[model samples]
Target: MNYRTILITALSCALVACQQTPTKPHAPNNLVTQAPALGAPVAVYTTAKNTEQRLSQGTTLTFAKSVQPSEGEISVFVNPHKSFQTFIGVGGAFTDASAEVFAKLPQDKQQELLTAYYDKEQGIGYSLARTTIHSSDFGSHSFTYIEEGDKELKTFSIDHDREFRLPLIKQAIDAAGGELLVYASPWSPPAFMKSNNNMLKGGKLLPEYFESWAMYYTKFIKAYEAEGIPIWGITIQNEPMAVQRWESNIYTAEEERDFLKNYLGPIMEREGLGDKNIVVWDHNRDLISQRANTIFEDPEAAKYAWGIGFHWYETWAGGTTMHDNLYNVAQSFPDKKLLFTEGTNERFSRDKYQHWPNAERYGHSMINDFNAGTVGWTDWNILLDENGGPNHVQNFCFSPIHADTRTGELIYTPSYYYIGHFSKFIAPGAKRISTTVSRSHLLATSFQNDDGKTATVVMNQSDDDIAYNFIVEDKEVELTIPARAMQTLVY
Candidate 1:
């Protein structure tokens, strides 16, 4: 598939072809660019410097015969032969609020946004998606598929989703060539099933309603599958430990473990949905290890869980980051997968939408998360209006693409370009390869795609342009990455 290049400056930027390099000869002390070796050992670079170029197709990078002796230079070593985690691909969420805004756009503009996000040749090529099981903070209002106090769930119907959300998802799936892997998550169960008798505040799932709630999942999954959208997995709850004004439910690790071990797990198996992934602890990475331990220590609960889900909010709140906690979880439960289920910039402002730092945050987190053993990454929203959201609870946040609901305009943020630097080139099932860099300013991760191609993404976060040597086996490509820029060297 042909991938479209993106520019950090504006959404209207069009695709540009790769430029051929000038063949000027160089002296021994200067950087020497040798042609790529025959067959397998070769590399080319495409970069987005956040100025004139965004995902600009650049010249092929040939490995030099020897490393040049220079000051303030760094070296990045890549080992495609030594690979780690298999990537599940990156994508965003589909929320009712997003669909509402999307439906307001003109038909042509709606297709443009979809192409910008899911078209493998012309967009970022998102392969996975998350959807709210009922309603989230991003929804226009609180809603549930089942009627109040319907303990038997005879009234359970996904007709609510058919209105806007599912249709938007179907279009995205079509654009992605029917390769979208969708997972469902609930912010809260129906108000009648919770202790507080309401879904807005922190409430506990009533013990009496446990079985019905488990069955509720089965019905919803079956309904969606009938609509041609397979449910890839389901999270126990979204941010189970937090109490928000928006819809939320509190499930201590113990509560979550018990529900899965006794209720959801057995019900799923009995209904022939056991193969569907059941993820635990859909919360922050700060307490991820503790939660994982609590749930996985029980052999019964562990058997029910397919993986662990986490978010990036903890680090943003001045708490600990992924390194310690993520390492702990990976080391403790090496067999289970780790997925970044939800994350996005907060306190939305239109001015910050184009902000490069926000985009850099995504790159920084993604590289570190991959190094820490995350298999997949999912952003929060696929699209929001110019106001950041039509969020019922006023929990506004920025998305990669923001639609001008009044004028039918689509605005692509810097995050879109930054995310494309990885998602556009790296295909699903790619394995994270070993990549070690000598300097602190440069952060990077390498992946060998399923197609037998290698992609190495390096970001220069420092203010000054720094020359670097990218070495893979016997070959070393010498190049200078501009300041505050990122490049993907794919071969």
Candidate 2:
């Protein structure tokens, strides 16, 4: 069900509490506890009103031997034995625009932000990152690697990105301990490759330029590798169905299938880069299944595609719900992978700038998407200015972190904390384990990482507090979650 369909009701604290501080040491009357283990379940919580707690680490919840799982209270049951999709990671795009503004900050501040995003011990380590093939809507201007009409690509250059993005990527790789898996996406083909002969608006890539454009992908991959920043994967095009005023190109499902089967896929194999992922349909959920089916049904095309990617815009736009489309794709292509490629709230509303609801959207979507079978999730822009720009098309959007390039000050929005509740604890290669919530309002997802640790994140979007027992392995840990808050328990 969509977020709007869920009925939100108030949950009373007395239902789950016995007159104790939420975070202080308190043993529920009936449960027996032993001495605390080195790695007991710890909770980190964030409240909506910016009250109570704000992504603060709370007291550890002790494991009990003999308490019957509360039947009347809401329950979150986690089953690591029944694991599912392996998680790739979570992160945001490293646009040239983001790097340009980031470069404006003092060197110390720049490193601070980088370390905050990529250092596992210091911050929420982001393992996956997206970068524009040339210039996306976030760039200062439209650009391409190849010079005008250079189909042979003798004059191709990534110099434009080297000025800002490449260096920042290298720094981020260092901060991440080289764990970053970078993926590249193109917003539009060069002006010469499109029938409209312009990159600023929707156009069609001429069939004649198919091979040239396919070669362009390899050139970009090789060039970035030369810079010490390997391109792990690439989407054929960004928002392939949209006709936007910004850098965009339209590719019908049939067109995309033919291009990949005949040109892109064959070339990658020929160049011995078959291992690099080729993701299809970098669009929204509204038509995701339809687009995916058209291409994936074609054995020629299906053999080359690593997975299907989608954005959350369709759900926010009141179109198809993200989870439904995700489930559809998962059921139909059980052998393939799924990824949440891009999403961000646009046209920042001052009324909701630091609003917890904005952050709630991220948690809500991520939980649902993960449950629906997405391996990785990537947000739109990693960083944006206070004005939400550097965007050439004037399409301003909110980011997890906003900075004052002029003052060198940074503002961490609730989105950052919400994402941290997941990305920080759930490491790459983690498997999404089965989780069931007794109350619909208590939206949650659980995972078991390769390290053998498990994390369960529960979010309460309702107006009341919830008293619930998190049950696993026949042991139970009782916890109370505040209304309009999220809690992550890592054990």
- Summing lDDT over every window of 10 consecutive residues in candidate 1, give the lowest-scoring window: 20-29
Residue 444 accuracy (lDDT) in model 2:
91
Candidate 2 residue-wise lDDT, 112-225, digit = tens: 788667777566778889999898889788888878999889999999887889889999999888758899999999999998999978999998899999999998999999
Runs in model 1 with CA error above 4 Å?
1-50, 66-72
At residue 343, what lDDT does model 1 achieve?
Answer: 86
Q: Which residues of candidate 2, in runs, are more than 4 Å off?
A: 1-48, 66-71, 316-320
* lDDT measured at residue 422 in model 2 versus the true structure, 0 to 100: 79
TM-score of each: 0.91, 0.90
CA error at residue 50 for candidate 1, angstroms: 4.7
RMSD of each: 7.4, 9.0
| Model 1 lDDT at residue 462 | 93
